[model samples]
Target: MFFSKLSYTLGLCCLAAGTILQNGQVRTTNYPDIKIDVASYRFRTYDANATEISYKGRWDSKKVSWWSAPGLVFGFTGDTVAITFGDLTTDTTLVGYRIGGMDWSFTNVSAGATHLFVSSATPGVHETWPFNPLPFELRVTNWAYGVQIAQVHVAEGESLVRIPPHQRTIEFIGDSLSAGMYTSFEGLSSFAYGVGAGLGDTEYYVTAYPGICVSDQNCWGNPRGQAHQWFYTSDTSWRASTIWGDAPEPWDFERQETTPDIVVINLGTNDNNSANNVSTATYVDAYTKLIQGIHGKYPKAQVIVMQLWMGFYASGNSYAQNQGYEQELKDIVAYFNSDEYLSAPLVWDGATNTTTKLDAPSEPFVSYFSTRGIMQHNDIGPAWHPTDVGAIKVASHLSQFIKLTFGWELVATGPEIFHETLYWNDEQNY
Candidate 1:
């Protein structure tokens, strides 16, 4: 039930004003507790690939998941912050933390919690006052854990600050509702991280998985060496391989440092699940070779092909009504737009057989993103996935369809990225 989430970081935070007891931890009545003069505090560890820790997604810096580094922003001048981590599969992990980024606080190290704290000053109060440094920014929520970070204490005269890196980036590849799973808190309420925190200076990367399959074989949830969780990098059967290293490989992406100006791709509902009946020419040749391997590793990415509100081999499937597979994802984005970057004209309305449209200069970008009923079933949950208010209304309509297909503007801070036009038609929804 760890749903504690609150964000207001449009640019690092430290407005200090903590106080959240009742077992909610986070109480720095304007800073003081460094054990209130435990010799002016001293801890300072910081090795989890420490470049002053800022690691973002597709995580494999030796195992860190939320389908890949879901979150781990760090910086401190202390009042409190400690997180050592090692083990916790407590019914599929759950540990969220925050401060300065307001509210959020959760933990389920399941009795063996290796260590975690984000108290701005009142965890076990004994207040003797005086010790204010405050510059906090603590964050460590990598839900659906694969925990392995091994240090980050912060107290010893504090100093770690390095939170800089966000100039647009989004790279979610999906399954399990774009890996935000039954959202009460999975992949940090996925929608690939709330469309990378509502596109505010972006920064996202996921590579989802659950019952993944874009057709690498007759699927059934990791059925048989399924290499369709978007050509792997993780998911050695949900991380194993003798300590994350005996299998699963093929995802180098030329050692990323940002190369995803948009990738989306929610993939075919487990190859049209009916026990993976996969065959419409093998799910259109493995979803057209997974968009020719994301156009040979992101050649100006902007892929996007979502359409699949929910489906896990029939335990309450959602839609594919008239399964023509949304016209085979508009013929695989018109064979990856083979006609000089498909300069608009993909209108096909066929009487609401579940919409399709790519009308724009749309160059180099293969499109289509219709999760059909666009969420409604109380915004889903439990197996039918999507629930964190349905991954925040599917990340606020895919962040207003990538801020109207790349004219981009909204830099987080709620609502108003305009350009709306996803009006469905099976009796309602817009």
Candidate 2:
């Protein structure tokens, strides 16, 4: 494998003034260096560590704590650091960086195993990007393919301190659109993260997988091929009726360090699969149950069920399927808006229907972007996925909805960025 010389820089060098805080210690650091165990609070998730060979040599005990899950975030208070990656055989392995929750950039693998230098540090200091060190979160949002980390390299005198978790958290649950599939933009989660950053301290969590559906049965034939599996592993293999909750086997919400203040559900793109052919009644019932389940888990959360975007659906002939998919979403939203409580107990099977229909207020809590025909593909990657510009447009509308609904301050939009094209190669196809 060879390294590609593809680099881009943004912003000027400046210093952000703030007192550092990490794990209840107010101690100051003058050493200019600190080694953080990946398992510490420095990393967002507490249970995503995986054993891997480190920058030192072998996979020793201490260094084996590298993060293995995609979107396993790590926050940094400093300006720059070197990230080490494991064996990458595909060009799809990517890392996304958001600075001060506004500026965004991505690093894709061009070499087998190597260290990538990322910084907003002042220029001329050891060949770093000359921007000031601001609060930043780096996420491997597209690691559905395999990618691993060994260690984070910082100056020998600086400390890798942990910033406290965001006060208000937003959770985005969906399919490829939410997974950052072909979008360089960080999907709805990043948009929410940016908006929440403006409103005191806020963070966002993502539970998205590519090609998954809410239909009880999909073309994949996995009985558990529903969108709720996000509460479980992104792994599409582990199927069971009782595999989600506050327990450690999959998604133990009680064990999760953060809970969302707002939850956004953007699905139905895959549910409209022409090959799978999910019935309208099946679609609506499955969607209703999913929303009810989310409400049951996070009662206080402001749940926003979104309309599905127009992707390149099933050889471009699934428009009717998509329309039906969208109507089911509207019916569910109307049902909830009409009553705070369900008229009947939610049935897991597609049998029960709630007799509540209310006009949806065209405001913050509701998203009608797809209905407005706003999410057109940027004509970049596969016709199926969105480009960076497209993702930004999606985020912009959602952010506006959040601002209007909660009266929260909104952050400025991030720079328009594009990820390298990803191709599935068997005979070298694009």
Candidate 3:
């Protein structure tokens, strides 16, 4: 299901210019540090008049709290605080924030309406609240360069420190599908977060550049610059040797150290077009060389070659023509496997229909719908990045595969485990 309007509220005491808000009190610090801010709103629904809110959990327990408001400021605080919401006679919205404890709960929130939650993290765990069966959108930002602590649901007595950061990190590289183009808030729910949460030991990153082909040689040159512009930052550049000879320098692929334990490359869809119909043989050779180049940099990284979803061609075409191109790409993976130098295997199991059409009412395709409805599309954030939901689905799929392939134990609670099971079934349908 998709939500139209949702709100999140966090009771916070803001500090004077450049001050910090902590323990429900505003204080100033000597050095510059990062903080989280939160904001929530209550939407009017049919049952709004009678909705109730309550907080349940151990008081003073060390836990992560999130907050968001206008602008992009978000923060987390650690202190004992009480949360209250609800109208005595009718349902009203109640919102508050806790400095650093869990022991809290809100009850009788109006059903059937989605709610939005936004939170940020500086150097600690950053999370968005109202996570279960989310009925609204969630936006999270991490400003602190250092990694922070963040978890969706904490066990009854477990502390935040006890939960470990994801062990395996997977990076997705490709165009819109891999970037999650044309998705909605609900679709974002199925994104990498959910997948990481499911695997219990994996983190996922989407480095997809919309409309970018596998080789720069095929890109529109000069003024247009192709979609490659989306992938490169002022600090980092991605030049496939098959197109630009040696790797482009001055740009830092090393500092972008967002490198993954596993890298899934899903480009080439755009490269298979009319102007760039370099024979499948030539494309495979180039793609294989590209894989070798990545391996040269990250020898331990596993590379997965992905196929197109549904939009590679026009709506009416049955996708037969592209299927052959896809097979040749698979052959490239086989060639790499034959080489003793490349130890990592290419993953090709999660291909499915594009999330764009699945969201439409006319689709009637519930069986394969990602947990958040659409699977691989981004609703917001960078032009074609996966929306939160789409990222969750990819993360979930990759996480499960990593866990099973690497024999990692599942650490999430029973309910979360079940959620992964449901997601797995949906992937099977694909």
Candidate 4:
């Protein structure tokens, strides 16, 4: 009878890898109760002795799978599942395992050191292994040292493959153009790494900060201020005391686990360069006290305040009191639409013209004082910021105004536009 139905499908793949290996541990029936923590990570230092980390996996796997040892070099480009951990000899830390039901962990990691342990599943199906291939067995430990994991993949599943409790979450505060700053200087396939590879396969949480500025100061010194940076940055270790102190108030957003249905605030170009500028009554009293401290930490999110595309006082004539700093940023969105306390309606002419025009200076310097003007142009990058095709046309116009005001579904396939010249040079050493 077809060899007894191929020996009952190889005895149900050896009783599903022996009920996902127990007693020694290695669970996951695809996601039964949700619990995967590796909660922190952040690494840098690329070649003083190699430290080029990259690990992404959210889905799409026609093949290629490995779990533990052999060092690193797994691959997959489309659904992104890249890993590159070359021989370091000195700084080394590794731990990765999977079974398939639920319960994973790995938090707030930065880089140079990290450790998360739990093990057991060793038996086969690493594409039917043989030459010394145990099913699974991770007991790993090293713990902490400079963690770096910037967004991992797979979060929850199986309620007919879940993922729709108002589409996970997302709260990206800004400044330094939502703190992507130079958007990783044209790399990781820019377009802010293709919107972090289309939200690193869902379940968002970016809490940005990159030269932060709304009016909390440090206009561009790079110390990250703007009333104390947040969205999430308590210690993903890149240290300097978590990127230059002060930013962890607003009652720590009542310790999140999920409380953001989109809150993207893109801070005024460093309060249009502070000093004698920030007025319109002090930029509407520090932008209504930072939108009342983000509505007292996300009272049903959905904030969205962005406008200023080509960085540093975004050219209106490159300042000289550029129309009173563009009418104090339109009176901070006209005081958030005359105090509706915003849930919507605050896109004050979302500027981004990317201006250009300068060429005419042959003779005009006879002991200066006045009488010689006409040299205006602006479009900066680097320390001045925004270039990776101007941060992919400001993330393709904020992903087409977040898919036309929240129909949300940015690029799984075009029409919301964001080619930005196919990532202009998608980062690698820029």
Q: Please list the C-alpha lDDT of all candidates, in the order they appear.
A: 0.54, 0.45, 0.33, 0.34
* Worst 10 contiguous positions by lDDT, candidate 1: 3-12
- Model 1 steric clash total: 2
Q: On residues 1-430, what C-alpha lDDT tens digit does candidate 1 reach at each position?
A: 1111122121012111112221233433332212222234467777777776766665565645436336667556656676656553322244555443244445444322334365555442223233123223322233234655666677667677766667778887766566654443455566776777667767777766655676666344354322354555565343444445545554566775567888887766666666566677877766766665565456567788877654223335553322347887887777777765355324321112122334444455687877665666655543455556667777888778778877777766632221112245796655
Decoy 1 TM-score against native: 0.33
Error of 4 at 53 (Å): 5.8
User: lDDT of candidate 2?
Assistant: 0.45
* TM-score of every candidate relative to the true structure: 0.33, 0.60, 0.42, 0.26
Candidate 2: tens digits of C-alpha lDDT, residues 1-430: 0001120001000001112222223325232222233333232211114221112101112222111113333444444555555443223444455544444454554223443344445333332233233334455533243344544555445544444554667776766566554333333233333333334445656565555677656433334444345445333422122222233133455545577778887767666766566777877877777766665556566788777655434445433212446666776777765634443323232222233332332122333334345554332234355555555566667777778876656543343223232345698655
**lDDT measured at residue 414 in model 3 versus the true structure, 0 to 100:** 36
Show pairs that collide, candidate 2: 31-157, 32-157, 32-158, 33-156, 33-157, 33-158, 120-131, 123-130
**Per-residue lDDT value at 419 in model 2:** 29
Model 4: number of backbone collisions:
46
lDDT of 4 by residue, 53-129 (tens): 11221100111111101111111111112122222211333233321211222212113233322222312212322
Sort order, TM-score high to low: 2, 3, 1, 4
Strongest candidate by TM-score: 2
- The alpha-carbon lDDT assigned to residue 195 of candidate 4 equals 51
Off by over 4 Å in 3: 1-165, 186-197, 218-259, 275-282, 311-324, 340-399, 408-430
